[model samples]
Target: MKLRFWGVRGSFAMCGREVLRYGGNTTSIELVAASGTRLLIDLGTGATELAKLLMQGEFGRGQGELPILLSHTHLDHIQGLPFFTPFFVKGNRIRIVGADPPGLSLQATLQNQLAPHYSPLNGLENLAAGVSIDTIVPGSTFTLGEFEVETALVPHGNMWTTAFRVTADGKVVTFLSDVEYPEPEAPLPEALHLARHADLLIHDAMHSDDDYQLRRGWGHSPARAAISVAEKAAVRRLALFHHSPDATDAMIDETVWRARAETKIELFAAAEGSYLEV
Candidate 1:
């Protein structure tokens, strides 16, 4: 499998000199399973870029379908849905899975982003006929093309976000987003179930130790917390993601470096456009 990061920032998007190298778009990841299946892990601002890239490929003429497995409906995570170009064209299917918390359905919550007051377009109803939304059974296993996916709800504030463990072509990749790690204790069973022995672990590293203390219930994890979980899961590589909107390239680099020194597990801050093969 291969992975590409479109956005790694958390909370909100930002711009300016300090974050140029690391990027400012929110969380979204593109995955190419070893079997050649294309999958997307979030629809944050970065999804716009991935959309453009896809436009230059098979989806350019709008002839295929795509699956977007959401973590949650947080604005920073799903903000790009309205801007994704494929939805505007016919014959291009977009299957959105996973329902957010409270009570709204997955399709309904996403339509809210495109409500008349928010945009001129009339929400999901305005999209081409190919777009569809499906809700999944929490903590259940499913399949997409040749990829086997295991999903479970995670602790992410009022909204229920999902963690994914995907295995394809002999490689295991786990995605952990908008989630918090329990201090002084192992990660929850669901997380452990997904992450154990993963070839690559993409985890939220939106805080530092101090930041975590200040924002304990914000549904984010610090470098230490994320690394500790990675260590416990025995994942081979940890790509710290969902960077704090205020974090600069230097700060992320230093944090990743420090964590790398403390453990044998390979660690690095995820940068937009960077990719790795598994």
Candidate 2:
């Protein structure tokens, strides 16, 4: 299995000279199995670009059925759905897997975002690659092609989000995204237990320790907290992701430096186009 980061910024997009090194797109990643099966994780603003890239080559043929695994319904996570070019293409289909959000139907949640009010692209009734949504419960395990996927519940922005553990070709990679660690310094029994002993753990490191106190309960963890989680989980490698939009290249470099100095785990900041073979 191979994992790639197409977008790693958190909350929103960032541009200009300050953010060039760490990139500016929000949370979207791809996991491709050895069997040539593709699993796209999260469809944030980066999904629009990914849609364009997917359409450029022979990728839209059979077995290109995209399975999108959504962590939650946060704006930064679902904002690009309406603009995904594949939806407008004929004979293509995308299956969206999301948590069964409280009170809101899956179809209603998608339609509300894609409908007239949110963006210019409206009325997806006629688009191809038309969405097929399925609500997934936590603790449920499913198979997508030759890979085994499992989900666990996590705290996120006053709502519940999912942490996914994917196993393919004898390798396990876990994605613990948009996770909020509680205060005053609560134990991470649940998260550590779920992510325990994975090959690679890609985590939400949207804040620095200095910013964590002010942003507590904001559905994101600081770089230090993310490192603690990875260390406790005993994962072989930790890839820090979901960078803050305001974080400059130099700031992120410092964060990664500090994180590495403090933890024994191999660490790297998640950047767009980064590839890791599992």
Candidate 3:
């Protein structure tokens, strides 16, 4: 299986010189298995670019059917749906999987994004991607092509979010977005179990210790908090993701260095276009 990152920023897309090193695209990743199955994670601003990439490769081929698994309905994660090019093209099948929170259903969550209050994509017919929505129950296990996925609930404000543990080609890859690690409690059981012994663990590290303290309950993890979770989970590799909008590339680099300095686990700052083979 090959894991490719299209966007890695958190909350919103970062731009200008301050974030050039880390990139400006928001959360979106593509996981391609040996059997040619494609799994898209998140539909952030980055998804627009990934959709373009997919279109470029679509010449002389049939419509591409891709599974888009969303962690939640946060604007930063699902805002790209309206801009995703494939959705405007007929025959392009996109399967959207997400959980519904108290205020909305899975379908309604997406509808809210496209409603008049947001944009002109107020109707499903306005989209050409031929989308199919599926609601996934958190804590349940499912299969997509040859990949086996286990979903678990995580603590997020108001809206419910999920952490995914995916197993494919004998490799385990876990993705945890917008997760908070409560302080003073050595290991966060939910995060640890999701990432435990995985070949690659992509986690949210949207703040530093100080920032985290100031933004408590915002549902984001500090860099050190993520590292501690990785350490306790015994993960082989950890990629810190969902960078805070204020966190520059340099700061992210520093955070990566600090994590490496503090632990033996291989640590990397998730970047756009980064690819990992497992």
Candidate 4:
């Protein structure tokens, strides 16, 4: 499996000279299995660029299917769907997997994002016709090409967000962003399950200890907390994700060092455009 970060910022997108190194887009990542099967984790603003890149190749040519696993319908996570170039093409197909939200269905949640008042595109009906959506059941395991995927629930941002663990190319990788450690003393049981023995654990590091002290329930963990989860999960590599909009390259770099000084885990700040071969 090959993993790449298209966006790493959390909460919202930020721009400035200070963030140039890490990037300014929200949270979206791509994983390609050994059989060339592609899976998109989120549809953040970075997906615009990814769409453009895909169009330049086979995906744009409407040659294959796209499977998207959305964590939750946060604005920063779903805002890019309106701009995804693939939506405009007729022959393209997108299979979306999301956990149904309260009151509205998963499809309706995304449809509302593109509703009349907010977007001129109006609705998903105007986009590709070959789209299918399904809600994921917690703890369910399924196969997509050569990858084995597992989904679980986690508390985040006043809602239950989905966490994913994927096994491919003989490696296990977990992605659990926008997660909140409400207890402040222990980690999520699902986090432990998904990240256990993982080659890469892409967990949220959107805050620091002090930040968590100030914003305790903001659906994110500090760098230290994320490091602790990696240690407890026994993951081989910890990729710190969902960087705070306010975090700079230097701050993230410092946090990386802080995590490294405390443990022997392979830790790195997930930067946009950076690729990890697993």
Tens-digit per-residue lDDT, 86-117, candidate 4:
77776777888878875669888888888999
Summing lDDT over every window of 10 consecutive residues in candidate 3, give the lowest-scoring window.
Answer: 56-65
lDDT for position 83 in model 4: 84
Clashing pairs in 3: 87-128, 87-129, 88-128
Q: Which should have the higher TM-score, number 1 or number 3?
A: 1
Ranking by lDDT: 4, 1, 3, 2
RMSD of 4: 1.3
**How many steric clashes between backbone atoms does each model show?**
0, 1, 3, 2
lDDT of each: 0.84, 0.82, 0.83, 0.84
Q: Give each model a TM-score.
A: 0.96, 0.94, 0.95, 0.96
Model 2 spans > 4 angstroms off:
59-63, 184-187
Q: TM-score of predicted model 3?
A: 0.95
Candidate 4 lDDT:
0.84
Candidate 3 per-residue lDDT, tens place, 149-236, comes to 8999988755567899999889999998788755723546877888889999998888877787888888888888778878889999
| Local accuracy of candidate 1 as per-residue lDDT tens digits, 1-278 | 88899999998997989999989998888888665678898899999999897878667777867888988889998888888888877778789877555577777777788899998777787877356788887798999877788998888865668899988888998998788866624678788778999999998889877778889887888887678778989999998899998888988888878888888998888998667886
Candidate 2 or 1, higher lDDT: 1
Q: Write the per-residue lDDT of candidate 2 for residues 1-278, one digit (tens) a residue.
A: 88878789999988788887778888888888888778889988888778887877444552257888898888888887777777777667688987876677766787777778776667557556567888888778998777688888888878888889888888888888898877423536777876788898999988989898789888898888778878888898999999998899899999999999998999999988756797
What number of backbone clashes does candidate 4 have, counting pairs of residues 3 or more apart or in separate chains? 2
For candidate 3, the clash count comes to 3
Which parts of model 4 are misplaced by more than 4 Å?
none
